[model samples]
Target: MPLGKGELTTTATSLHILELIVDHGWVTLRGLVEETGLAKSTVHKHLSTLRANDYIVKEGERYTLGLYFLTVGKRAVEFRESYQLVEQKVRELGSRTDAEVDFTVEENGRLILMFEAAGATNESTFGTGTEFFLHNTAAGKAILATYADSKRDEILDTQGLPATTNKTIQSREALHAELEQVRENGYALNDGECVEGYRTVSSVIKRPNGSALGAISAGGPAYRIDQSRLKNELADHVRSATAEVTESLVEAQSTL
Candidate 1:
């Protein structure tokens, strides 16, 4: 039996809504309407379809990714070669520096923490599976610095460079200047910018294709990780870790 045009359109809209929700967890109906720019009735109808499909679920008045998303995300993590190598690098960095290390990747214009390891003496403000605005973190800055001007502009336009803290780089111009420094310095630093009293240094890991696979960050309390240490010691360690992980990735890819 052939489906009617209205039914097909409804199905398409429902899929689109599900895509948005899966990418960003917990969105209000108003937020969805604004994000999709669809009429309220249309958005509601699509949300209903997505709810029925188990692709999304409502909590109070907000909608979020469902069990299905967890299953998929887990599968994606399992298949990612970068995650495995990055995890090893994180552990090594943590053990060497006595600091917390995180492996982050930029996905859909956001920094996703894929894995984390903490040294015996380390403490940190962030945890595993945490996500951050790509324009505000050391990991994000390192990754963005590798891209060309047009690519960097496109990424900033999509991510919007939102201010997460007073210390965050709020203006695109400022972020651009920061990225330039990252390129010159061969690493990036977040000096209590993402969160007060916490500092981090990071570097990018590139795939064989020269695209950013992810980043490696070494972080500790601001008292121990001062501006001077962040610029010199932490930055150097993170860059070495990044190189180690990328080499492992390249070797693994060659075997496959």
Candidate 2:
């Protein structure tokens, strides 16, 4: 069987409501109408369908995401065995380094933090389920560096580099150059680019098919993860974790 476009596509309104619910945790019907500016009746009808399908759960007047998504998300991870591989690797790396570690992948033109492990440090880092842009974060840049040149260019052309901090790369040319460095150095460095006081070192984790599984990163406060520490001390740990994951994936693929 070949892939075919759906002849009857669902409206985006229901999905919009789902996004709103996910973003704000629990939301009321009135809040949905206020934010979406849809007629009260329309919002009510859509939400009723969502609730009926177990896509959302309502307690009193507020609705939150239902357990259905958890099942679906877990299946997604099961399908991508690379996720399990990356998760265990990041956990071990975080324990040894005592810095924040995360495994991030590109999804819908943004970075999705799929797994996170906290180091001994009191300072926190990016958490799971958070989304970030490619041009500003070390993990994103490491993933981008492994992409085809044309694909990378097209994505940046559509979503121009939006700065999150003063240190964020502002031009495609600059990002391209930075990725080159990432390739040469085997890891990407984020020096307060994603946030004011955070720095990260990341390396792309490759799957057996030569496509990127995601990126593994170790990040901490800038004072501790400064340039010297990022390059000389932490980069190797990130690269080692990514390399080991890639090897396992490649070996698994060879058997198949």
Distance from true position, residue 231, model 1, in Å?
2.5
Per-model lDDT: 0.82, 0.87
Top candidate, metric TM-score? 2
- Give the residue spans of candidate 2 off by over 4 A: 1-9, 121-123
Predicted candidate 1 versus true structure: per-residue lDDT over 53-109, tens digit per residue:
888889999999779867887889989756776777788888888887888988877
State the displacement of the C-alpha of residue 204, model 1, in Å, after optimal TM-score superposition.
0.7
Q: Cα lDDT for residue 18, model 2?
A: 90
Q: Residue 25 of candidate 1: its Cα lDDT?
A: 70
